[model samples]
Target: MSETSKVVLVTGATGGIGSAVCLRLANSGYSLILAARDISKLQAACAALDRPGLPSHRWISVDMSSDASIASFSHELATDGTVLDGVVLMPPQMRPTGDCQPPADMWRQLFQSNFIGPLELLKSAISTMRPDPSQGRGAKIVIISAITSVQALGNYATSNVLRCAWLAQAKTLAFAMGERGIHVNTLSLGGTLTPDYVASIDLRATKAGVTFSERLAEETLNIPLRKYGRPEEVALAVEVLLSPFSDHMTGVNLLHDGGFTRAY
Candidate 1:
C-alpha cells in the first residue's frame, strides 16, 4: 500500500456483512487488515478482496473472546507502525439464551466477549491511529450492533444487555475522541438475511410447521419495508460512515432496520 493510502482494520472480516464491507471499502481504495478467529476463512476473505489494481489486504487471527489473544493482537498492532485509519467492529458471535435469566457464567462470558474485549481492542486501535484534522486525515470507528440493542428481544437477553452497553460506549467514545479527529459511531441492524440468520429463520419455520417463505413473511410483517436487509446494503451504509461524507458525524446511532425500529 502507498504511504498515503488509508488502512482500515475490520474485525469479523470473514462473516457475510464483514466481507461485504471489506469489498466496498477496498473498491473505494482503502487497504484493509482483516481480523478474525479462523485463519483459513480470513485468508479466503483477504483473497476475495484482493484485485489487480486495488490496495493489498491482509489478515490476522485474533479471538475477540480471549483476553490473551486481544493483548497479543494489540501489541502487534501498536508495534507494526501501520498508520491505522479506521475500524469496523462486528459484534462477537453469540447464541441466544432464549430466556432473560441466564446463568451467571453465561453473563460473564457474554460481557467479556461483547463488552470488555471490544473496548480493550478499540483502545489499542485508537492508540495506533494518527489523526490530524489539518492534514485531512482523521479516523473513523463504526460499531456494528443489532436491533436487540434498541428493542427487547425475548430470546436474546444477553445481547439486549451487551449491545446496549456497546451503544453507550460508542457515544462516550465519540465525545472522548472527537477532539482528536476520530469519529465514533454505531450502526444498529435488524433482520439482515445473513447465513446464520437464514438458518435461524429455517429453524423457526420448522418449529412452526410452516414453509421458509411463510416464516420469513411473518418475520417481515413488522418491518415497514416488508423485507430483510441485504449485506451489501449494510456495506453501503458503512461506506458512507467511514468516508469523508460523515466527517461531521459522531456519537450518531444510525439504524439500518428496514424501518423496524419504532423508537423516537
Candidate 2:
C-alpha cells in the first residue's frame, strides 16, 4: 500500500460489482468515498470491509437518480477538502417486468443514474483532479457497462438503450477530459452473480412460476463462460482502468464478458 492516499469514490457501492471495486480499491490503499442512497446498507458494507493495512473509507448518502442529491453529495466532497483520484460509476440493477416493453420512467431513471449522475460527479470534481496543467497528475473515471449493450437483450430494453448511451457519454467525456490528464474509460461486463442478480431471479421465478435457481440457470446459459461472473473479477478490470498502467488510455471501451460478445 502506498502512503500517498488519493480519494476514490464509487457509486452504487452495495451492489455486486460495485462492492468488489470498493474492496479492491480499499485494499490497494485508496481512501474511499462510497455513495449509495441506503444509509443502513452503506454503513453495514463499510463495517464489513476488512481494511487490514489499508486506508479508511468515507460514506455519503447519494441517490444518483436525483440530480439534487448528486449535487449535494458532490458539494459535500468539495467542501471536505478531499480531492478525487478515481471514480467508478455503477448503475442500478434493473430487470424487465413482464411487459418486455421498457417503461418511460425506467429509461428516465436509468439514464440519469447510469449516465447523468456520474457525468455530473466528474464535472463537479474536475477542478480537484486537474489542479495544475503543469503537473500532469489528474483523476481517473471508470464506468461499469454491460455486454448486453452490444448484444440485444430480449426483455431488458432499458439497459439495451441506456448502457449504449452511457458508453457514448464516456467517450465524449474522455476526449474532453484527457487534456488535463484525467482518464475516462468503460468496462462492459457480462453476467455477474450479485445479490441483485438473486433478486432479479426471484422476480423471474415469480413471473414464470418456477424456482429461483431454474430462472437463474436459464439466464446464465447465455453467457459464453457458462457461468455467472464473480465481483472480484470485474474489480480487476476496473483496477486496470484506474491504474497508471492506463494513463495513456482514454475514450476507450474495454470488454470483460468472457467472449460473450463475439463481434469484437
Candidate 3:
C-alpha cells in the first residue's frame, strides 16, 4: 500500500456486513480503525483483515449503546491527533424482528443505539475530519440503514422505525455539516445475505414451521432479483461513498437492495 493511504473508522466492525466492509477497504489499501462493543470479536476481525506485510488494522472497544462509551471513544480519537478520512456507521446488529410492539425500554435502547449514540460521536469527532477547512480536504460518512427504513417491514417494526429515523438524522447532519466539508449520507439496504439476515429468516421459518429454504424463498420471491445481496456488493457501495466519487453527493439515501425495495 502507498504511504498516502487514507484512514477510515468502521463502527460495529465485527458484524457480518461491517467486517465485510473492513476487509474490502483493507484490500483496497485503506488503513482501518475497527470499533465494536467486544474487543475479542473486534480483534478477530482485525486479524482476519491482516496482511503479513501490510499496515495492521487497529481495534477499539466501543459500546455504541452507551453515551459514556461513545464519548470516551470520541475523546480518545479527538485527542490522539488522528484525522479520519471516512467513517462507516453500522447501527446495532441485534435488532427486533417480530411484529409485536417493543417495550418502552426496548424502544429507548434501540433509539440510543441507532440514533443518539452515533450522532454524539459525530458531533465530537467531525471537526477532526477537517481540522482546517482551508486544507481543501473533506471527510465522508456512510450510515448503514436498512431498506426497511424506506419500505416498512411488517415484522421489523422497531428496526423500520428506528433506522428510518436514523436516515433522517444523517440527511439533517449532511446539511448541518456541509459547510465544514463533511459529506454525510445514508445507505438503506434490503435483504443482504448477512448472518443476521439468515438467522432472522431461520427464526421465521421455525416460527412458521416451514423449512428454512421455504422461508428464504418466500422472502426473496417478491424481490425483483429473487436473491439476497452479497456483503461485498454492499461494501462496494460503501467504498464508493467513501471515495471521491461521492464528493458531490451528500444527504442522499442510496438504496442497495437489488430491487427489493418497493419505494423510489
Candidate 4:
C-alpha cells in the first residue's frame, strides 16, 4: 500500500459476485488487493487483470473461515502501510453438505460461511484502514449480502438465519465507525447469473424436496423483473457504492434484487 496508491481489498475474489466486483473495481483504477483460499483461481483472476494500462495489483491466499488466516491477512495489510480506500467482502458459501438436506453440522458450517466469515473479514480489514479523516483517507466497507436476507426461503436455514446476523453487523459497523468518518454498507443482491448460484439452486432444491423445474419456476414467478440478474448488474451497484459517487451514504442496505423481495 504505497501512500500514493488507493488500495481496495476484495476478499472471496474467486467467487461469482466477488469476481465481478473485482473486475469492476479494477476498471475503476483502484490498485486491487484480492484474497481467497483458492490460490489457483486467484492466480487466474490476477492474470486476467494484468491489463496493458491498469494499476498494479496483487493476490494472496487466505482462508476466510479461519481466524488465523484473517489475522495473517490483517498483518499483511498493515505492512502495506497505506489506509485502504474500500473493502468488498464476500465469503465462500457453505452449502448443505452430504445427503442433500442439511445436517446439524452443515447448518453451522453454512452460517459460518455466509455471515460469520464475512464479519470476521470486515472487522479485520477495518482495523488496518487508517481511521483519521485528517489524513485524507476516509474508507468504505461494503458487505455483499443477499435477497434471502429479507425473506425466509426454501431449506436455506443456514443462510436465512445468518443473513440477519450479517445485516445486524452491518448496522453495527456503520454506527461504530460513523464517528471516524468511515462508511459501511450492505448490498442485498438478487439471483445473479453465476455458476455458484446455479449450483446452489440445484443443490438446495434437491435437498428441499423440490424439483429443479419447480424451484426454477418459483423464482421466475417471483422476480418482478422476470429474469435473473446478471453478475455485472449486481457488481455495478457495488462499484458505485465503493466509489466516490456514494461518499455521502453509510449504513445502507441497498437491495439489488429484481424486485423479488417484496417486503418493501
How are the candidates ranked when ordered by lDDT, highest leading? 1, 3, 2, 4
**TM-score (C-alpha, index-matched) for candidate 4:** 0.84
- Please, what are the lDDT tens digits per residue for candidate 3 over residues 1-264? 457778888987888899889989999888899988888898788888988656667877888789889878988888788778888988776455685677889888877887888777766657668624577677899999888778777778888788778877888888888888889989988778888778878999999999999998888898898888989899999999998798788999998887877665
lDDT of 1 by residue, 1-264 (tens): 666678999998899899889999999999999998999999888888888877999887888789999999998887878778999998676677787888899788888887888888888988999899887778999999988878888878888888888988999999988989999999998878889889989999999999999999998999999999999999999999999988999999999999998889
Residue-wise lDDT of candidate 2 within 108-191, one digit each (tens)?
Answer: 776787777767876776656643446657678888888766777766667777788887788888887777777888888877
Best by TM-score: 1
TM-score of each: 0.96, 0.85, 0.90, 0.84
Poorest 10 consecutive residues of model 4 by lDDT? 93-102
Give the root-mean-square deviation of each candidate in angstroms: 1.3, 3.0, 2.3, 3.9
Clashing pairs in 3: none
Better candidate by lDDT, 2 or 4: 2
* Top model number, lDDT: 1
Q: Which residue pairs show collisions in model 1?
A: none
